[model samples]
Target: MPSENQGFSVWGFIKGFGKLLIGFLLLLQGIIGLVVMLLIVGVIVSVSDNLAGGKAARVDVPKGAALLLNPQGVLVEQAEEVDPFEKALEEAYGVDEPDQVEARDIIRAIRKAKTDERVAGLVLDLGGLYAPASSASKLHDIAAAIEDFKTSEKPVIAVGDYYSQEQYLIASRADEILMHGFGNVVLYGYGSYEAYIKSLLEKLKVTSHIFRVGTFKSAVEPFMRDDMSPEAKEANLAYLSVLWREYAASVEKARALPQGSVQRYADEMPPLLEQANGDFAKLAQRYGLVDDLKSRPQQLAYLKEKFGADKDGKSFKHVALSRYLKAVGEAEPDGEAPNIALVTAAGVIVDGEAPAGVAAGGDTIAKLLKKAHDDENVKAVVFRVDSPGGSAFASEIIRERLLELKEAGKPVVVSMGSLAASGGYWISSPADEIWAAPTTITGSIGIFGLLTTFENTAAEIGVYVDGVGTSRLSPLIATGVGPLPEVAAELIQQSVEEGYERFLRVVSEGRGLERDYIDSIGQGRVWIGETAQGLKLVDKLGDLDAAVAAAAERAGLEEYDVVEMVEKLTPFQRIFGGAAARAMKLAGLDFAEARAHQSALRKLFAQIKGEIELLDSFNDPSGLYARCLSCELR
Candidate 1:
């Protein structure tokens, strides 16, 4: 039935068959390569994770086990609480989750280990502890707990390849501090820096309209100016000096290295290195900053001799931080409980609710406070505040809610974290007692508002517009409006001054300081926790738990539960957010891997980009803001 031409085309038929065969072979090979790559990625990641975590559930601590206190990754107020399945998937796939250890968890673990008979001492492995200077003092409490152990002569050994300034604070408390032969003891004293975008804005012909009350309010500097203002420089220097002094004093006392050893070492690090022929290990020993220089195995040998080796004699028996936490369990208060509510106002103060990383939004925190207030079993509220400050109205809203808690007969105690400046200080004004760490950065009592218009930018691109309005200040603000209308600028400026006055009054009444005195120390000035306490901006120097204890005492409760008033992740976000992208990236299929990473980065950047969308955002239907832009220190 074939046509005559089709029957005669034998060579053409052979060529078609060969091409089909080649296409099929290529498709098969690609499928095989993909499967193999996936299998390899899975096997490697699964084995590593399973080996690390598969046995964690059943891990048992043997007798005389020392707690290995090595904190890796980021330390935050609270970690995102994930379900078991999500957590397992994350660990297995090596998904990027910022390693977070709660201060309470650390304290509780140390306290439990101190009491547990099987626990002998602590190994201060804080090499990976990335924390801000304000948090340095918070960790001091854990070191204090170790001191309790030291009274019993339990040897606390500190070991690390290198010690950052923050890590050295905790390390200084150890009985014996060891470093690697090549490791350096670095102490670049704390200083803050900012990026000026004014020139760029000018280049793009975008105009910024700024309103601020305090001379020391440097938040608007980046937009309007290139460098730090003289007043800002003076204020920043004063607080940074105070913080440095505190740091030096602590290290000097703990190391018994004389009055000014820490300062001297900092001032003459180059000379000291030269003297030791650039041998940092030698310099550390010569300066008494460290007791010895040893490699990992050598340090292991030292521990083995002191604590007695494990059954295999490979190393000393020790309980990891995670293992010890599980073995000893979280600190549950004794007796019938559920009385104290510990609410955290950690993160940048926003106008509305946000997830874990972003911290307290005004609405979210208000709801949380109300939630605590409504609970009949909740007797006292401990507000643990750590913020660089955001919305002025939002901070006031939070403070008003705290006032409500007081009106409802519930005592509200405030514990300041690393940063509680501007709006941070505003919200804490009404607290029954405000406790801050010696290293806590607080008190940037100021108000500022920023707006941008791009009329000039549009003009540069050959666009022009003229508009008519019913009122002189109609559409007071807009993206294409050049040099914000005079009437609108005056209004914003007036609001900022009033907001500042209100802030002054709040601090004046709540802190029991004179209006003039508060003003003298305020004007957007930051203070070290120690200096703040001296200035009467803080009641006492203590940790979050201490604040909780004060709250419990004020409520007259001998035995109470400390419930966390923190954000809870949604079910969908928990199951599919972090773990799914993590799984695909770990699979190494190269399928949208870049996109997967972009998703994670987007989560972090999206929050920041959305932050400055509108000056009205700071105005928030209220007026200007009391945000502390300089409160954050990198």
Candidate 2:
């Protein structure tokens, strides 16, 4: 009986070990299968991108062909292609990444289209196209280019499913504007809205001391007040008015109409549509806003009939902008070296070097600028700035490096994208020339910093913080304690004041404005491009192409090739990044959530240990430096 029991136990143990080994093998096989699948998908994507890249290869343009100008995405001062997976992940996680098409590229295309002998006309297609602020300026500039083409007796046509105010403004420049039968044109203006956080802070028992310089600098008003300050309202109105006027004038010039006629037409649209039995297309034609109402197939057929058929029986010689640009080539033998350096200062201004999406780090930008400056073939530099602004010291660091470029005799032109306000404007102030669209948000000349205390929260929780230091004011200083000492407060206030003055000095020098005038307009005031133009803050109301033209002109070159500066990640960097991403995915960790969780964990740990920490949290600095928290691009 004992021998039989021992045998049963040994068999049971053997069975258990065998099952464990089989389970382990299955798990390994599953992991290998997943990895192989990912590799296959990666290969497919790579091949697809390669094919898309090949679409830029040269194509012949037959005579009498109409150039199709389809611009998709934001117009940047430079175009860069990092790993698309990185870009996709960043978007998925709600992190900010700088992705834009260079303004110079847009302008170059327009110029080429205008001069191409085989191109008989131009087509402005507004389908699935979102013009970035810089692109808006480029569109206007391209409209002007089309007008220049018209001088040679060529025609320009614009077609769209619907026309927003911005699209209408650009299409107005076409010799003939065409709309879909069911399309609508809505002319809505711009507005700035602030977010109020006073009540939330109050509930949390956190006291915020807001000290700011500019009366028009309402960036900090949301925390202190519930609504827009009278000063902010007045400043925004002034700026918007100037911008609207400029927009109206540009549209008029492009359409070859009377000065006030476009405005009159736009204003009379609602009543005219009512009179036309509510047919939007009919009203558009009646007001001379559109020349015809047609479908895409019909438009294509009409072009085919007009231009004749090719040997392959394809009607008309249609040259896409991408293909046309490729044929023209991005380089020139006699033109300046195709070594164009594109430096992007996008997002908020931060202290250290980091990857795309977050604010432009001072260290990252400075290093890039230094590298570009050192490159002998980089004849000109295009500083593509799209930021709301951040740390005063960081902005200064970037601005200083830009100054170094100017000192080195390289022409620096700024291509302002959406929300180039406050610290954004500060860094851009040093550019040799600034280009902005009528709708571009820019020029917030202001300075601010925050110091928050949770004394009330600590008291409520029956937790007290005590400190001892060498200096009398040291113990009372830092975060999480009682109110700042009077001396320390005075010191910070003075520092802020000094920063404001320095900001004014930079603006005065950059814009060539007087100190008094800058002070009057400078108090952290945000302005649209038109008001900025009137205030002499921006050099021109134009886009990236204009900036590049200005830069080339400044360099005394009639034409130059544009080269985009991109940081090339090493092989090891790419390998490590892929490995890390795969590991995260395997662990079911969403990187963004992981980061937030880690931050919260650190904060909780610090609290539990009764430690005073200087947290570099994202905050809307009040007063002159306060930005529109809810004002994001649609």
The local distance difference test score of each candidate is 0.79, 0.69
Q: What tens digits encode model 1's per-residue C-alpha lDDT throughout 1-634?
A: 4776787688689999999999999978866775575456556655665566533345577799788998776666665464555456555545555566776677777778777788888888898778866565566666677777777767789999989888888889899999999998888787878788889999999988888877788989999888888888888888888778888888888899899888888888999899999898899888999999999899899888877888898878898888777776545556367579988887778787666554568988898999999999899999988887888878878888998999999999999887788888898988999999887889999888877888898888887657677987865644345447788888888988898999999999887889999999888888888889988999999888789999999999987888877666534334444444544544555434334435758666545654654332453556467777676665
Off by over 4 Å in 2: 1-65, 75-102, 132-136, 195-209, 262-270, 308-317, 332-347, 354-359, 376-387, 406-420, 431-442, 450-495, 508-517, 527-564, 568-579, 582-634
Model 2: which ten-residue window has the lowest total lDDT?
A: 611-620
- What is the clash count for each candidate, in the order shown? 0, 11
lDDT of 2 by residue, 388-487 (tens): 7776777778899999999999989998875688888888999988987776778777776566788777778887777777886785655565756667
